[model samples]
Target: MQNTVTIGKQAEQYAYQLLLQQGLQIIEQNWYCRQGEIDLIAQTNDTLIFIEVRYRTRSDYGNGAESVHYHKRRKIISCARYYIHTHPAVEKCMIRFDVFSMSRDSAGEFSSHWIQDAFQT
Candidate 1:
C-alpha cells in the first residue's frame, strides 16, 4: 500500500498539471513555513492562488476535499500569509484559496476536482 506521503505527492503533481493546463502559471510547489505547508501556489492574471491538494484511495471516512476542515484551513491561511509577507511583489495581488481533490475509483482510475475560492482567510 502506498503511504500517505506518497499519495500526497502524487495528488499535488496531478493538481499542478491540472492548474497548468487551465492556464495558471506555477509560482511554487510545496511551500513550507513555520505556520504550515501550502501544497501548490500559482498565479492567474492578477490573482495569487494558494491551493490545498487532497487525495483519497477510499471514501470510507470522507472525500479528499472534505478532509480539509477548519483547522486545516487555518493552517493553510497562516502559511499563505507568510508567503505574502516574504514575497512583496505579489502582496498587492488578489488572493484566492483553492482545493484540489483526487480520488481513485474501483477501476483504479484517478479523477480530480478543483474548487475555486474554496474558503476565506
Candidate 2:
C-alpha cells in the first residue's frame, strides 16, 4: 500500500486504541454509508461516538483537525443519521462527534490531540 494510505490506517488504529484506553468500548471501526465514512464508532456509557481520525506528517497546509472541512462534516452528519436509522439498537443512545488529530515529528514520534465533542449541529 502507499505510505499515505498506510499512515491513515495506522493513525486510525492508534485513535481507536486510544479511545479504548480512555474507557470507550469499540462498537465499530471504519463505518460507512452512502453519505460518508466514519473512522471509528464507539460507545462510552450512554454516549455513542462517531469519530473522525486525521493525521499529517507535518502541518504544512494545515493541522489534521483543520482538514475536516464543511463538506466532510455534512457528509459525516448525514452518515450518522443513516447509521442511526438502520441500527435501532443505537437509536436511543446519545450521539456525539469526536475528532482525533495526529502529527509526527521528524523521527516519527506521534503527537495526538483528542477533541471530545469536537463539533455539533
In candidate 2, the residue pairs with backbone N, CA or C atoms under 3 Å apart (3 or more residues apart, or in different chains) clash, namely none
Maximum-TM-score candidate = 1
Q: How well is each residue in 1-121 modelled by candidate 1, as lDDT tens digits?
A: 7888987787788789889999999999999999989989999989999999999887888888899999999999999999999999999999999999899778766799899999998
Judged by lDDT against the true structure, how good is candidate 1? 0.91
Q: Which residue runs does candidate 1 get wrong by more than 4 Å? A: none
lDDT of each prediction vs. the true structure? 0.91, 0.88
- Across 3-92, the per-residue lDDT of candidate 2 in tens digits comes to 898988888888888888999998889988788798988998888999999998768789888899898888888999999999999999
lDDT of 2 at 99: 88
TM-score of model 2 relative to the true fold?
0.94
Task: Give the lDDT of residue 27 in candidate 1.
Answer: 93
Q: Which ten residues in a row have the lowest lDDT in candidate 1?
A: 101-110
Highest lDDT model number: 1
